[model samples]
Target: MSSNQRKSFFDLSASGQKKRLKAAQDVPLPGSGSQSSSSRREEDVPDSPVPLSQPHPSSEDQALGHCPRSDELELCPSASSSDEYEIEDENNVEDSSEESSNDDDHDDDIGIREKLRNWASQYKITATALTALLHILTSHICFSSLPLDGRTLCRTPRNINTVEVEPGHYSHIGLKSTLIKLMSGVSHTINTVILHISTDGLPLFKSMPGELWPILGSIKNVCSLSKIVFPIGIYFGKKKPIDCCLFLKEFVEESIDVINNGITIEGRKFQVLIQGIICDTPARSYILGTKSHTGYSSCIRCKQEGIYDKGRMTFPSVNAPPRCHEDFLIQRDLDFQVSESLLVKIPGLDLVKNLPLDYMHAVCLGVVKKLLLTWTSGPVNKCKFPSRLVNQLYSFVLCHNLSAYCSILGFPNTI
Candidate 1:
């Protein structure tokens, strides 16, 4: 070691005074003569008392002064051996400290991962948001081992198979697996899932002929609000499916399996019941293999014969005999059902009873709105309201600020 390094290393010991005494005895006078030795003793001893104002040399300074110089190589051989031992001790301490630091870094990484996952779940954060956050973190912090992609962090599957129901047409996402995933967290002993199925044709654009028909479902009496609606099947076509039964074949088969055998979730089997199938008049007619809404025997609830009115078919009877499941099974009315529906294959499903009239079509957007429009804007007859009454109604609507209802009435500008 250098002279400065040796001084610093020996300074850690409390034996500085003993080492100085030993060094003075071992180191002989530079010249071989009595005169030289007498001169050295005189130089070591002060001529007069050190002035109090000048201060005294500290122990550290004394230790440095007595430290062996490079030219006196043969004088002190033990100091070199002592330095090697201290250096080895320092190297071992450094190794252990590095190991401990590595462990701390690993724990920190786990903590960061758990915190991010909890934050994402609590806020229902999107993948894009997580990806942005990860980019910022990786740019500023040194965590190259952590996943950079949001999908990987979110644990999203990469190899999901898309089932094609028809060529360039429909796709079926497995219903059984979806149900298991959705209901896996339920803690009930006897789980009962009441499912509601709905389907409708969706026009993609007004300028294009392309359209989509997705079969969606929801679980009734489910506590979780986030998973209300899920897709079971979807179809893209220039027009509606050629055959309704073929379109619904996959869905019907799945429904039958779920209702009869039940599905296992988290090692517990859940009994699924088909609560209802909801659809508008046109969609309902298409799925049930019945005539269109304009047909004379289009009403699915009852066997009420429709009469030809001023411009269209109208069902005026309020107390018509209700249609039964037996009538549907037997195909009692030839005019009503054009073909058998695929829904009949499901064991416990009722074609007529289990199919409820959709609220959006049967009430809010259909009967009530149409009746109001007919009374206000129809031909001048008993159905048309008086001019004074129509003005009062318009004023009432304006006073209430019922813009949403007026907009749905399709007369926002006129009103």
Candidate 2:
């Protein structure tokens, strides 16, 4: 770690909010964010230019010193969810420099060292609360520049080998016929996986569930976050806006390979998010009450026509409502270039279930956070997406091509 990073790490054991703020300055920002020596005035600190860490907004409004916002709470990966659980763990940092080599390296020195160790133990407790808050802020700002999840599909003669065509859902798994046809129409094999995670979801190794099996074995890479919510949401059907970004992070990580190896397919793309709880789906209606459903609303990550929800309505589709917003399409061409590599029939719940809870939680939360943040935050600097980005166009073999797609499949209002 760089000196700045080292300081930030050390700040993990800081005492007061002031010390925490000072420590935050050490996490230098890149490019234009860093301040130039010439621009530095007597009061202007070196790290001010980047605005890497903004003063706590709440604190700015308080008297005298900072806002004294909710006394910086504890944010360790291992803590109870209740307010009391956020209490700082009493452990301080040892100032190794203070350890004297004198006392002829005898028992006296040992006593002095123990004294320092004890003091440091208490220091850690002092720092924990501040550290947690700062980390919460750091995680959030760190992921502000995330990209969108691009779901694409490109098909042609090479990958398609389906001879006998049936109307109703293919009864059997039809592994060979379907896989080959899917493969034949496929132009590539790699996929770009973006995994979005919330603040709480980062340390997934310690939390993911052990009940599921891996569907993609070893192919995973290239993830990012649209927002920084803590603690990912992994359990089946759980959804929390605070944890929505986690899902996007995972997919982005795996997407790099998808882009490199997979052929093109359809091009519709959406982000994912992990709710703090088990989210059923994002589709709102009488289902998602009035509170904006945040990450719980159906996102492209979980966007699939259920038994009959289909077509373009306001919320759109038979399954979920029309999309609240669609800002995750920056890399449409990449989507057009890689969507075909995806298995349309893959089990969403089952596949995600295999991941550790923390991992899955992070992925789900990250995706949701990013999408909502970007959309609600409104209008960002972006280039017009390429038209080719829509290549994931799927072809349906309708009994009578009679308006295979109904303009308005369901009644207006909620459903």
Candidate 3:
């Protein structure tokens, strides 16, 4: 079957999305009204697997739950415990040498015995750190593996279509943020946002050093631009069969000229990012590190030092790496670098049909019901989106890791 065969309601499901996209022309789009009607149906809402030591029956994102469950760990692992080695078989993690190393990492994290009583309080984002580390490691193969077996920053690719939304770019308002904000007017609310980075094939996870290819994507949100770029939303409807490929084609070509040109913030000029994520509700936003010109891409280091099939060991030299800090402490998060947000809707399995608007609204409200933990509304540069918010968002994906990937077995995420 074609990769697009079982795509969801978002822009990916279109029959010819891939084949037709080549010359880097603008990816075609469906009118908001028509595409909304093209929403995919939810064929299934299977139980998302709960991670190690997490409560089951699951909520929005079971896979991400493990991050928070670390909260359950007693302050001291050696204080006195019969079950110190309790590895929940139900966690459903990949049984690999990698995971074994992960367990050791977890144990070492808990056993910092020189013990301090106020450690949790001293570390403001303890939960945030745990959430990021576990979620990135267990839930996303794309993120957990160290890039390049090391780290290599990637440089901007050549001739990526550029769009400058504002006159100048601000330090905080990188390209991705500018783009998402510019397209905000396109949708009343975004129900879902599918984020992926492209490479020639089997793209290396963001952590891998010097390993990358042009990272491309198709964002399906309520609004429709000529091509697939940031601000993906989806209304309820049956998306046209050709939308998938058409969108890819159009998106690859049309850079948000307005947003890309430049944004002068506080007098300094900066380029805008091409990619970003928007999965926040009234409380906060969880921005994925998909700035334009960023994300999965080949690096100069890789091109120069890489062997035919193997990657070279190069950290620190990896240019243009994803924005997030890769250390286990703060990996796999969705910090907005901005104010709080609200998630209006979240769809189910099939891309076409949504998980009842009311239901999604309730879910977002319930999880993020309390806005007490929001940021101090600091400037965007700090990603003031609040670590808690990012953790919650990661929780959404981590919780669904197994089930979601299982559904796409044919398209195993080689990340």
Q: Rate the local accuracy (lDDT) of all candidates.
A: 0.76, 0.30, 0.31
Model 3, range 1-415, lDDT digits (tens) per residue?
3644432212333444332222112322334234331231111111122233433324333322212222342232332222333443334454666699889876654453212213433465354454444445445553343222111112224443432212211111132444455455453343333333222212345564332112234443434643554332211112111122222232332334323454443334444333332222211111112211122221211212222323432224455333322211233322222211111111111111211123234354443433422333445555357667756765765556556454433322211
Evaluate residue 376 in candidate 1 and report its C-alpha lDDT on the 0 to 100 scale: 88
TM-score of each: 0.63, 0.15, 0.14
Summarize candidate 2's per-residue lDDT along 288-382 as a digit string, tens digits: 12122232232333342323233322233455433221212222223212222121122231222322233233454565555544543436445
Model with the higher TM-score, candidate 1 or 2: 1
Task: Highest TM-score: give the candidate number.
Answer: 1
Model 1 residue 270 distance off true place after TM-score fit, in angstroms: 2.3
Best by lDDT: 1
lDDT of 1 at 155: 82
Whichever of 1 and 3 has more lDDT, that candidate is 1
List, residue by residue over 175-194, the lDDT tens digit for candidate 1.
78888877777555457888
Each candidate's clash count: 0, 133, 91
Error of 3 at 34 (Å): 81
Scored by lDDT, model 1 comes in at 0.76
